[model samples]
Target: MKIRNIFKGILIGVPIGVTLIDSLGYVARVDGISMQPALNPDQDQTDYVLLNKWAVKSYQVQRGDIIALISPKDPSLNIIKRIVGVQGDIIETIGYKNHIVRIPEGHCWVEGDHTGHSMDSNNFGPVSLGLITAKATCIVWPPSRWQFLSSSLPESRLPLNLSPPTLLYSA
Candidate 1:
């Protein structure tokens, strides 16, 4: 009878745990060298991060946020990249790279911090917002490196056209 009770607990616990993770967030290991100094800084070790699923549920994201998304070239693969351009923004890509490309509605341009080494918007074009899986909130593993990830974009990487800030009018 005790064994049966233990089995019952396992059955009930598993689904609840899965539901929480699916609705909330989960820890994921960073892979590859594409993110460089920000992520996998040392080739010998890796960083594990908390990927927040709730942040992506609304299909909204800001530039410079590191996000995990389904690979545009390969459906089976998921990749992490920084949002460089949002919908309606035009980016002037590095070194002769320009296509009359304005990020399409519901899409964003993503690229790795390492550049040249990443498989990102530069290779496959902007990714659909639907493909975004999560936003990385912090590094969870490797005790030496634990901190919240903040949104940041390099000035050189800023979009060519940004909506002008609203001006205040005094009555």
Candidate 2:
């Protein structure tokens, strides 16, 4: 009887924890140097960042927001990248096959701060909104690294033209 109760408690606790993490936010360890000065900044120790899921639930991601998404080529993996272009905006690709691309409906273009080292939209193309898991709101760990990540796209990365009706659709 005790064992059964313990099992029940674990099952309930697990889901609650997962839901809280999904709805609220959680800290994740940075494994690579893709984000450069914005993230790890160093080669020795890593940083743990707070990823906010609440902010992304509306699918209203803005340019320069650091977001986490399930990799398109490999759905099993999750990658962190900055939003370079939103739907309806025309973006000039970096190393992508095409020189310029208009972010398709329900999709957004992502890129890494360290251009050459990171694998982002330049490699796999724009990602669907459904694939985005969360937004990196701030760096929570490491006292020296604590700060809110602001929305500020590099001037070179901005789209050439902004479409007036990005969210419009005709049924």
Question: What's the lDDT for all of these models?
Answer: 0.90, 0.89
lDDT by residue for model 2 over 50-157, one digit each (tens)? 889898989999998999889898989888889999999999998899999999999999998998899999999999999998999888778888999887787778
Error of 1 at 32 (Å): 0.6
What is the RMSD of candidate 2?
7.2
Residue 135 shift from truth in candidate 1, angstroms: 0.5
**Ten-residue segment with the worst summed lDDT in candidate 2?**
162-171
List, residue by residue over 1-171, the lDDT tens digit for candidate 1.
999999999999999999989989999999999888899899998999999999999988999999999999999998999999999999766432566478999999999999889889888887899999999999988989899988999877888786354467967
Clash pairs detected, candidate 2: none
Give candidate 1 regions above 4 Å deviation.
94-97, 163-171
Among these predicted structures, which one has the highest lDDT? 1
Off by over 4 Å in 2: 1-15, 162-171
